[model samples]
Target: MATSPQTRKAIADSENALRDTLWTDAADRLWAHKTSGGFVTTPKTMPYVCRILDEMSKDHPLASTYEALWSYTWANNAFLRFNKPDDVTFAAGFSGQRGRRTLLERMRRLQLLGFIETQPNGNETFGFIFLPNPHAVLFRHQAGQGTPLPDPAPKGLSTHILPASWNAFVARALDLGCKDVKLLLNPPPPAPVSAAAPAVPAALTSPKVLRRRPKAAAKA
Candidate 1:
């Protein structure tokens, strides 16, 4: 059932009151965009992306590769680009050959899963990394080109993700040079409505619900 306006307003007011009481200092926090090291822009529903990563590889572990990429990205640029002279060495965080090999393997896995695109330079395979919107990639994976989903495909992947989130993902993908127009905009169909589901009240769903003023308040 949809939330009543009074209940929603009460919850919001309570949360605001709590914030006003608890978070008294801004300096104590390490701001993402303003911080010295900078931060990565991730999807709102990032857990879905993490679950998808887990399905791709069990040995490498989910989010490890994802976390590594975020660590390597030090810029606060909107493009979400990551580059360095010795990117392999920097990304691996080790000078040894073993570390390089492990990083390389992880990079390949990410590439295969459509998370990143590598621009090779001479001997250095992953010299440049282009991070794609993971949510967009998730949508593509679900489409599956008429083939059966891989054993690792997350359950309820499409249904669980929101349409607004999908729109953001598509926009990001396009900005980052995604050429496949059809696939990016092609979202999975909405979930089938259940016959037993309760009907939502028109007042709750209408846009002007919050704008309506009480007759006494209007008179004043």
Candidate 2:
């Protein structure tokens, strides 16, 4: 579809903002691992984690790197962009260990949330974990949980969405965490089938009711 100038500009602006802030520093620091100890959750913790991720992306296995990347995508969304998926990743370099965390911690959080069962593989320093809301992970990467954003272009043959298209946008976002998603916006409630459904039925119209309750109660 032909993207309008306004929509293109907005998408471009958003892309620039994300790249400059999250991707730049993250790509540079992904591989620096921390084997001596775990992550320190201090006021300065973010920088340390970012550094480790920077090195890991380039050095770790593809699976490990993707995990770290997704992790960073989630945290970045929560911390920076207010809990939305960064759809720009479709174009932004998807490689890089932009996100990683202690495996014990990851497993604990996942188990606590009842997203998965816990098991040990006997790996130290960093254990692998399962994430149930991988789709939400995408949304957390692409879109946030706050008041949804306005789509720059109206959806037609192809485009993001039109202005004030919160429902469609949210539907797209929710699809990240849900499967076979279907969203109905402002759908009218089903109309009542009968204007007046007889409490006692039509009675004489049916022999069963005429035999059960007397006609007087039926009429009343």
Candidate 3:
């Protein structure tokens, strides 16, 4: 029996709708977690997220890696996920002979490019984290003036492992006039100083200068 074109179209539409709903649900959960401070480190803002997606989509070699990241994000219900590179590769739908190595290489490439960050999980496993440009516009719209920047992802969630080449990547991003995108590269602020600590004496705080007048007089 031949399936009618109308029936096929309906099925396709249904799949699309289902996928959209899943993505929306996942995003909502992540947003809720962020609001509740479940993520010690902040997830990338929507704008930054969108920008990263755009860049990854344009890179053919990174297509599978990008999909893997999306899957992990959905599975974790947040931007942080605890999984080995092999696990992520399998989750991305890569199977069969040689698929694992290929996927692992792709993951490494993404990390080298600064699209993803990873930290050790103590048991020889790794925790992967996504770093996208922050959504400054959305943040401003929702937070209004004087709003603090987003917090870093929780230490438990990600070690915030950065590659040694990260400096070069940041420099390139800034040179490209991508100030907003480069915001993610900045280090988090230091923890606030304790108010209970004793203050240093004013005299000790002042700069000291050595007098050279005696030496000059001796020379003359």
Candidate 4:
């Protein structure tokens, strides 16, 4: 339910005026020719990575977990070389041992929601996977952007992530062209180890700070 930045700038100006009046036939032998191989290179901000994986798997049970990790990251070029034989039960179509235990419980819920990173292989526990930078892990799962989830933070697991669905996923990937992309929305906040530490106020540098839970911890 995104597409709003003025209808994604009028559908990127009607797909750049239909790619400036598309012309085709360079003696066309039926198009699909990336030097005669199947294509895989992906992110022109893939519709903001499929609406941030459908608003972060709306009430997840790994709801198709971004189409089974885009069919197990089809021959990935940018890092993420998975253990490919049988390609995790053929991308979890449910084969033997219930499709390798449902693709190892959807890659351990995409590595407990930070969207992947694994290595174990002797026992084949997701034999090598990495894939971070899901727009800097959805701006560090949004709740306060200081980045601290992954430690018993999965009981009712809703790591906020709303800021108008992260500014309509950077305004539909900068109206579909996706240059800079606000440098992946937000990341560079690490340096200050201790220049005599004491000044973090301006309302706690808010990317999120609305605390008022305690109605029995909001009836947890």
Candidate 5:
């Protein structure tokens, strides 16, 4: 997921700089310095990357978590696959040595959100479509600001996303006696063009047709 030209270059730069500061054979020495427990001498890397995963969870609350899950099934939600320090450092957006704490906090929060589902084998995954309809949980059982389900909108607030398309979906479901329906929120309207007035052509400017003011009087 973090595989890109920018990321690859960043990794190289980080490793080279680290090698210069730590030792010319720092990479080799570090690799060989593992303990009897099969742990790296510098074992802070896992927690650091986990923190990045956490931030991703916090950012979208549910949407991003769903994206994360769906990635395994479809796309790899921009999650950095490389756990190496240099590889992670090179990855933009996801890589932030400074943002480690924030990311961890978010991942913890997302787990509590019920958005992430644990598989039989204890695999953690998320998906875009709530195949069984997560909206049911939000509308009836569990719902709030931070959970997997979307928060309830204000009273009488109907959705407008693909009006015809959604209505068709609702119609199909309604026939099966489904009482509740949830839809994606529509984006805000574009700025309104001034229909009351005609647009002025840039070529026919007031300075060309009307009187112009002379330059301001200057002090002697």
Candidate 6:
């Protein structure tokens, strides 16, 4: 059955509200981190995190999983470790939607892309620890240093390309505090240049011209 326009609008509005909530939560957490010295060594990391979250699209296959994991890590300021695959699976929200193997594969892809690093516990009873490095990933993305791995699943695949104006979005997000949220959705204009002072005319600057020829005609 075809969906009505009102239904589509309602769906869009809900999605947008969810997105806003996610970012606002991220921003608030980042502010808390800032106050608590979470970024003392790497103050630059906070902005990168905000930029990545702002640029992330809901259509990405691992968007929810990644966001959830990042939020967990950011709040705790530590790696998320699990003793069982079920723990990791549930945390990533892949219990019914996907299997543990798929979760591991997605994590491996993220690791390869520099977005995450994993360390095995060496005990079969203990699963692994996932260390998220969104700042490093954002830097690598900006520098074109790594290739984004394609998702094996057919549904909701994304190229994961960073837009050229990512920095501008980050700046606006930090300075404006979500006042003009639509600005981040659109492409940013070129860097603003200061307006130069108006040029003075040569005619105005030079001395006034004297009419000496009229006097010669009167003599003739």
lDDT of 4: 0.60
User: Which candidate number would show the highest TM-score if scored against the true structure?
Assistant: 1
List the lowest-lDDT window of 10 residues for candidate 5. 40-49
Q: What local lDDT score does residue 192 receive in model 1, on the 0 to 100 scale?
A: 100
Off by over 4 Å in 2: 1-103, 115-117, 123-128, 133-170, 174-179, 183-220
Per-residue lDDT of candidate 3, residues 1-220 (tens digit) = 2346797789878886887787866544545653674334334332334344334334425545555565556444436565556677677667778777767656554454445566766663345466443334222222343222236521222212133223444444454445454454454798998779788787766655233346668799
Candidate 1 residue lDDT tens string, 143-180: 66422434665332222334554466555555544445
lDDT of 1: 0.58
Candidate ranking under lDDT, highest first, comes to 4, 1, 6, 3, 5, 2
Q: What is candidate 2's lDDT per residue for 1-220, written digit by digit as tens? A: 3356798889878886887686777646555436544332221222322233232223321233233333443333311121222332322234234422333333233233222333444543222334343333223323433222235411211111233343444444443322212222234689888787647646556977546877688799
Deviation in angstroms for 135 in model 1? 1.0
What C-alpha lDDT values do all the predictions have? Answer: 0.58, 0.36, 0.50, 0.60, 0.37, 0.54
Residues 118-147 of candidate 4 have per-residue lDDT tens digits of: 787786776777676566666566545634
RMSD (Å) per prediction = 18.6, 18.7, 18.4, 19.2, 21.6, 16.0
TM-score, every prediction? 0.50, 0.20, 0.33, 0.28, 0.24, 0.42
Off by over 4 Å in 1: 1-17, 26-32, 35-37, 74-97, 146-220
State the weakest 10-residue window (summed lDDT) of model 1.
Answer: 154-163
Tell me which of candidates 2 and 6 scores higher on lDDT.
Answer: 6
Clash totals, every prediction:
0, 27, 8, 0, 4, 0
* Candidate 3 similarity to native, TM-score: 0.33
What are the runs in model 5 whose C-alpha is more than 4 Å off?
1-62, 74-93, 98-104, 119-132, 141-220
